[model samples]
Target: MTQQTAPCAVTERVIGIIAEVLDIPPHTITPETRVLRDLETESIDLLEFGVGLNAAFGIPVADDTVFLTSLRVHLEEARHADADPYKMMAGRYPHLSCDRVACILRTLDDGPVLSVQDIADYVLHALRAGQHEKAPSHAG
Candidate 1:
């Protein structure tokens, strides 16, 4: 698939994985669908989802703390600098919507379970950051 279509493919795969793990129909999972609020995803499910993402995309999908901490730090810095939090976050996470960022900010105390769209955005970020690559072959 072309670069333009790669995101869509990744989104579809993410939804498929979520649906399978959650035992929910793929049709019900949208980019805005909340993992914790809507699906009531358990901790184990989140762990499995992270593993699935890492395995599928060849990128690291660590615990939410890393991303959450980074977001909080950015927002705090933006607030201190008298910058618009949404705009600052938009600059960093171009793939996410303003509404999504707002939702994440509002839910900061809740571990930022993240929407399907959020996960897709993270995957895209990883791909753009050059985090995804084939393992080096050791054939001699």
Candidate 2:
């Protein structure tokens, strides 16, 4: 694929992963959809999203806090920008910086291998931690 074509394809696929994970209609999820507003995606969802992205691109971006923070920045920009969200994300996230994104695209472009459910499970675990803290206990 040409350099130009590659990003478009990757963006579409990445958004698809997000949509599928959130159980929302893929068509409704523009790249601009705020994880909080449009999708109501929780933080756990973001973590899971990261995992799916890593699997797809063939890169290890999980431990890279800098890149994860950058991805959040890009996502916020995309949500606020009045332009093509996928394109905006493509420019901000870029192929080189976001290893998780690159890994996701690679996984998609190469061949179907692993499922994203494992990653989703990880996300649930993270979400539960917060919930556990807030829940009232009756251990008397």
Candidate 3:
């Protein structure tokens, strides 16, 4: 199945940020691009990415929300704790589809999959959530 691209204002900006951090052409980056695996990014790159995104989007991405920096750790922890790893991953990465989460869990030994779309999704989610939090409140 071909993954449909989710092109948007936020997505384009994310790609630009990623390309800059990775020192690659923006055209090479796509929603399906895997940051860690495909881009060969290190932990420092992720930190720079988090900073870049925050600077560009004004959204807090320090937590494992936008990026699945601790995917393996979380999964292992869930297994050790006798918890449903799927449920935990789905909860933490609500931006990703359940199918994607399942796929990530299945091939986790190969590597964690954190796509650009996932990052864009979390940015959009955070922006929407922030808007709601700042909305006019009748209870105020």
Candidate 4:
């Protein structure tokens, strides 16, 4: 029999993976949990999380530095353009909403960090882009 996993289940498993990697109690982690501010996840921790996420979801996660660099480049270009940055991001990154782009911009301008929701959104985007596949099961 084929096992179908719901998206919420996948999100929960992602949260579980984050909790395990960070050695934090699962109850304390939420969608809004900030990897840096809330969990104090450093560069190494993010690297580990990226590996874990790839292993769990069968997705290729670019190294944290590469991901951040690309994001920063986009943000930098938007900042210099006359068009609204959030709108540009929404148009450029169709998977992400304008509000999400705004949040990412705010986080970039105020602090360099990403929330759990942001990571999940990236995963979803990758999935939609045909760059990832849902895990066979949650066992991972």
Best by TM-score: 3
TM of each candidate vs. truth: 0.67, 0.43, 0.81, 0.74
Show model 4 residue runs off by greater than 4 Å.
1-5, 64-70, 81-83, 91-94, 106-108, 133-140
Candidate 3: worst 10 consecutive residues by lDDT? 131-140
The superposed Cα distance between candidate 3 and the true structure at residue 13, in angstroms, equals 1.0
Q: TM-score for model 3?
A: 0.81
Between candidates 3 and 4, the TM-score winner: 3
Cα lDDT computed for each candidate against the true fold? 0.75, 0.48, 0.78, 0.68
Q: What is candidate 1's TM-score against the reference? A: 0.67
Number of colliding residue pairs in each model: 0, 7, 0, 0
Which should have the higher TM-score, number 1 or number 3?
Answer: 3
lDDT (0-100) at residue 104 of candidate 4? 80
Best-to-worst order by TM-score is 3, 4, 1, 2
Tens-place lDDT per residue, model 1, 71-119, is: 7788889999999988988887665667777877787777654678778
Per-residue error at 32 for model 4, in Å? 0.8
lDDT of 3 by residue, 21-43 (tens): 88999999898888888897888
The residue-by-residue lDDT of candidate 2 on 1-140, one tens digit each, is 33412545555666677887788777876544444444566667767777766555433444333123444455466677756545654554333324445553454334331233323332333333332223234479
Q: Please tell me which predicted candidate would have the highest lDDT against the true structure.
A: 3
True-vs-predicted CA distance for residue 93, candidate 3, Å: 2.2
Model 2 misplaced stretches (Cα beyond 4 Å): 1-5, 62-140
Residue pair clashes in candidate 3? none
lDDT of 3: 0.78
